[model samples]
Target: MTDDTMGRFGLSRRTLLRGGLGGAAALALGAPAVRAAPREVKISMQRSSVLFTVLKVKGTLAERLAPLGFTPTWHLFTSVIEPMNAGAVDIHADVADAVPIFTQSAKAPLTFYARERGAPSAEAIIVPADSPIRTVADLRGRTVGVSRGSGSHYVLAAALKRSGLTLADIKPAYLQAPEGAVAFDQGALDAWSIWDPFLAFAEAKRPVRVIADGNGLTSYHRYYVVNDGFVAAHPEVVATVYRALVEAGAWMKANPEEAVALLAPIWGDLPPAVVAAANSRRSYAVEPVERSQLGEQQAIADVFYEAKLIPRRIDATDVKIFQPPTGRG
Candidate 1:
């Protein structure tokens, strides 16, 4: 047939050969193969995610997902769980471990797909350098800034308990990152419980002392969560996204300079050195979530419940776990 006639068939010679081989193989197996329709996956992003930020900037995730008939639609959120729980996003990037605990307490249906190993030192409670507060106990009766359900909140609680105090012992100014930074800079809050790169930014620009970090208190794992319904309906898409995250994390760790270069401008033009310092505190090793490793999550949930931060107690490990493809870490 002529080129125009062949073009009307909408099949190239190579494509025909591949299709025939596939058809013969399927017939040999006595089953028809199937392919899913193209799908759109809404992924959540935040400035805190150095890994996803780099991946998003590079646009490599889209290229990686294209082969699987999935398109990525990224939505930026200051906090991920609320929007993800509201059905605003399908895939949630890594968020502090404590975030999911609160979501679970609220009965949000989310599945844990992957986790970044604990980088305990990534968050801390900071006081002015010359402040009289020299220890965790000093925080009692002091006005402290903290994001209510953030990882730093749990760290603050654990730190205080170690020093014979509780959330009630202090006057907590429940503030988001921006508000917390402003309050801290203006000396309205005695101390701020926060995580990087905010932690890194504040330290670089201000005179502060870190009274405590998550080191001995919590692992501070960052988790990737997916809406439960989406998890069941589009497992393949979830797996692809998981693998892409794993690869992106690995790439960032391997190329520190490039990673910082990509992150600096995005982090409000923060100095590269500051960004590097913040990144160094995080463990970019993404792995599948296991029930046994959830001890810290359970502790966070119990602590929050006891502190009356969450309305109800939750079994942290009761949520669904999405297994990555076999042979993945």
Candidate 2:
């Protein structure tokens, strides 16, 4: 068993093999470990959201994430799907429930990581103060402004079904929020299907009426989405961002006035009162995405597919849903 005894025997083949094996094992165990690549959490921002602005300006999110080794960066965006598809953003703060369905149908590499509780009244179908459109049924044969596959789209669809009307019953003027708001103001549109703070902005400056809102019509569960590439590579970073958002959401809900004050200057100089009114309709809560949420997402997908708005049918649950870090360390 002694090295000197083995050497005295002039090195048997078995002993040589044992010594070689020990040396190799020692080399393998002594090797340094390779570190994972550093990742940045690049998030897309929107002035329309209350939490995102507050989170960005207050820097509370950075403080929370610094402990976890990440600091999210924000980018401006107009649509939920475009910037992500073009590689301009890594995550979107609050995408509508119906958007990922269209992205999936288009074969975009995207997934949902976090979701919001239903805030139905946050979006609605509005008309000018003096317009003859008194109910959802009154939209018949008239042009209404809408952005296809948005939460507003679902609000319009469900409101129509309740009124015994369908998308075919009215002419759709496909437009985003600002452009749509402009059309509504200039009398080029009979009605506009929009969400807040655009909803609040329109009401604050113009004489308009909400004929029908999402209160009883749409799912209204907005989501946080990530690029498939980003989630695959930086799950922990994504999870960190999600947790920061959860924290920021709680802070905003508990301190509405502070959120409004933090957001007013960032949100196109929106008055604090108007910002407060818009934030009131929102749930300002974040929860993990699960099967219960997927059902309405499937309904949204089927509706869009049936209308030929999306090229193909999609299973909403097929995409990635973030499960909180269950000690995945």
Candidate 3:
């Protein structure tokens, strides 16, 4: 039967009462009101960069929401910080550094949704394998390339402090990931502080060594944040997206090679070997944001404040709004 006829006449007796029409007489006598179909949810995500693994392997935000009868419109952003600030994207997926900037600028209605579980390694400090820079201390008096104000900048600062050094100890070359990667190859940069898969790519191409990862050294909590209004209006959609990401993370751990294969094509012709290596180091589980995580993030903020990276002192914990895990039935 046609949908209209079914709506008008075929609703079960129980359905009529539950729908608040109270009686079958009402259903038969009154005209059936056609309810609007749910609109598709559009989620914005950054293209392949640090959060690439989570987006590609954990299922693109759009792919996950498709099963829930939500058509996810995937909008690509070059960098998470810019898209978030410009209100170009619905969700920003990357490290939590942007949270403070967002809060300070008040450029967007954004809130921290979740963190990647188990202290995920989102960024690192690396030198070419053949380089003489052996440790964080070795970076002193040398040019260190990093994206200014990015997570790499935060990692660089924290790593330097660990070795009794500061940003002043090294020559800071502010370059984006692609430019920094190229500069490092040309020996223009003595060291490169960057996030994956650039870090993974550098390691694969040459004899690069990791001076520091997101362990005790860096408060690199990868975050999934959304436009505040969008989140409030469609919490269920956000929850569903998070559930898919958690499952995808589990799948990546189980099938690393398969995950790599799934992501390779979307990387815009990155070498397969590099993609494979990068995939090995990614963590995909979604965890609820905790106080400890916020505290670590706050440390980064303090460092930035001391270094004069940003104009104001930011309270990092204020923007962290955690949501419970979306349980799958």
Candidate 4:
């Protein structure tokens, strides 16, 4: 990792916190100090999300929240958008930075708290080793399997734009990462747009070649989103988890091999080298979301809108950012 990236966040940085429950208000006003809600919370992620998967396997979130009295229930989902909108989890651990734009357009009551900056090289478009596709231009009339509303989706869009083609130029196969892998291997699709861990696995186990990756075309930032209710109910706990994630991110960077080993068991016994290859491309530098960082999200939204993938134009930053909640003494 570069010194600049490492310096973006460190374990030494404390949350900019100042918030409290009505208990504090009650104390100040001399009324009954109403107890806060139960400390239990739910977190959700799909295996496709690398950081959340690592966090789940390491058991760090549970460990971090223990002192805070949180009862964290792990919820597995096919994708985050559904569970997030359905309120199945308080924390939607990591979803593609582009996804929330579509969700926001749908008016889901979710918000962004943390975001891992772009590691565009981590996401790519792969073709079978022997395929005749020589360039992004060659993909013009081919079928490409991709996860809908994913960073990989944005990667494919950005890559295509550089080739002077659009989504309409190719037969887009909207499949989840796993399904895309199967399709690519079985030749059900002409090419697969995927992210690492899965991308690394495909390159290792399947005869594939990266025809194009997201470098120079996109910023593959992933977001740690939360249910709006969770923020209102337990802002302190949210801040704590955010801190825990930053620490975990640092740990991942400092010890990549160990991170790979830790993730092997949870990722359906993925080979450590494949996991490591995947890990190599990621930043894993978790940071608080800022309005400035969100500039690319607007471009992502525009990409999806032009593709007609999203129903309408939406401000990518319309959802609230979880500030270090400020409160009365």
Candidate 5:
């Protein structure tokens, strides 16, 4: 009953455990308590991540997680999925729907935590004003520039499919936004598939014609993903991060001018007008990822596989979806 009595009986908790009882049994008999170690939350964000930038600027997530014994570390990435798959990132700010499909195809353990509502006009296939390309059909046999495995890549695929064509119909130039912009500008590419704020930047800098956007093709939903291990280890941290993201999105939408002013310097010093235009096309409403709404994700996966873009086909809904805590802690 007491430490003195147990010692007098030569039956201390450790002695009992050594006499063949287990740790749990010994704990039930009043063993010393164990403490969990503090965790480091590695959050990854792309340069174009407006809401995440807002969070970083305000240090909102860090403040929220500090009380939970978590130290938040932010990492900027150009290609986020690779770092996420390599376990270098604990939480990804957000990426296009096609990004997850590609990561899943590679067998990376990922969990969808939150999703931005679909913004159909956020990305498009554009061509120079003087170009002969008029519709998606005209893109056939032309050199099209797009980032490999990116959201705009899916837009290109869906747009081509709608016109009874595929990636093979065009000579694909796999390039990042800057490279694609250069190629498109130098009269090298027949068409370029891109997303905002790069899309807005390109349109403002030059005279271009939009052949197609995500309107009837892809939803262009951005998703916040987390490492499976992180989700299992610190669910509370995940919930906190998700709530912070939702709040940041709401703030960005509510205060457009302030959002632009805050983002302009961080966004390569792009003009406020360009930032506003880009922000206008995006729906920053963050919500849970519903299983029923993953139809487009499945479609993106199937299309990529059909076009031999991914190594193998993946079940879009096979990954985990995190639900935030309902009540107070």
Candidate 6:
């Protein structure tokens, strides 16, 4: 038959040899499958801070991945967003708000693989116990200090909105957490917007009151995200790492006292009481991203967009890399 006739009849020279109909049979008969080896991953973590919960997975992850032939390297980043944006780190452990901000501003192709479940109420706006800032409404016309672009900034914005105030209503002083804490203590700033364990530390010394926390104001769910490319290329490794973190989180919850002792040596000789207080508020479950969680994150993004904190609008759900929840011991 002519070439045109063969094409019309759904029979071609190439198709005949490949045996489209019998391909599975041929493969099942003698073809050998090729499997690729696992890739090494370099996980980036915050050097020191309450963000150091990443350390909980250090050795456990290595042991977990032994069978998969995956090796994990731990590195420290001073700021989670910068390293994540620059592609200097494959994974980031920080507040969920960071994901939306970076995704909107830096256009980083990052995706959330998992989040700490049970919504730990860790971040908040703190006023000295003697300070008159009892409610969010009281902050109007006063100076409020927050780390620009961090989760604290988002919390501050939400707190203001809840109290019928806007950023313009208050004088915002941009400073790092440490500097802000010092300034707050020294009476340079009226209030400090911060996250734990710094928040816990500040409360321990002198007296500080949590004017508002992440409970109703923010999702504040800590997340473990990797670059989209990295996640797509090494899903198995990502799954393995997440599994280890979930286990570590559970361990911390079960043994808060022991967890504090384990973290003390690395966290600059913090008082046991301070560490215990911080640990009490932290949840360590690696809950998979759910629609409600994404909705809350989207709300954060929308608020930031309306406030012009980010130049453009973004869809929070577009950046998530969802994986089925895996049980861990």
**Separate clash counts for every candidate:** 0, 0, 2, 0, 0, 0
Most accurate candidate by TM-score: 1
Residue 68 local lDDT, model 2: 59
Evaluated with lDDT, which candidate comes out highest?
5
lDDT of 3: 0.69
TM-score of each: 0.87, 0.83, 0.78, 0.84, 0.86, 0.80
Off by over 4 Å in 2: 1-39, 66-70, 326-329
lDDT of 3 by residue, 154-200 (tens): 87888888899999989999997888888988889988888777777
Model 2 weakest 10-residue run by lDDT: 31-40
Q: What is the lDDT of residue 40 in candidate 3?
A: 59
Q: What lDDT does the true structure give each of the candidates? A: 0.86, 0.79, 0.69, 0.79, 0.87, 0.73
lDDT over C-alpha atoms for residue 170 of model 2? 96
- Model 2: how far is 186 from its true place, Å? 1.7
lDDT of 5 by residue, 1-329 (tens): 68898889888866777777656766777767665665788888876687888988999977888889887888987777688678788888698888998889888888988999999899999998888889999988999999888999999998888899988889999998878888888889989999988898888888999999999888899999898988998899999888888899999999999999998988779889999999999999999988888988999999999999887878897879998875545
What's the residue-level lDDT of 155 in candidate 5? 93
TM-score for candidate 1: 0.87
Better of 2 and 4 by TM-score: 4
* Candidate 4 error regions (>4 Å): 1-39, 325-329
Q: Model 6 over residues 52-130: C-alpha lDDT tens digits?
A: 3544434667677767777677776545667777777776655556445655477877777777754436788889889
What is candidate 1's lDDT per residue for 199-292, written digit by digit as tens? Answer: 9989988889999999999999999999999989988878877887888889988999999888888888988899999999998998999988
Sorting all predicted structures by lDDT, with the top scorer first, yields 5, 1, 4, 2, 6, 3
Better of 1 and 6 by TM-score: 1
lDDT of 4 by residue, 1-329 (tens): 34454367541111211234345544654555554654768888777666666666778777777777786777787666677667777888587777787688778888788888778888889998899997888998899999888888888988898889999999999988778878887889988988877788788877788888887867788888888987888887888778877777899999888887888887778877788888888898888888767878888899889888888988776669986533311
Score candidate 5 by lDDT.
0.87
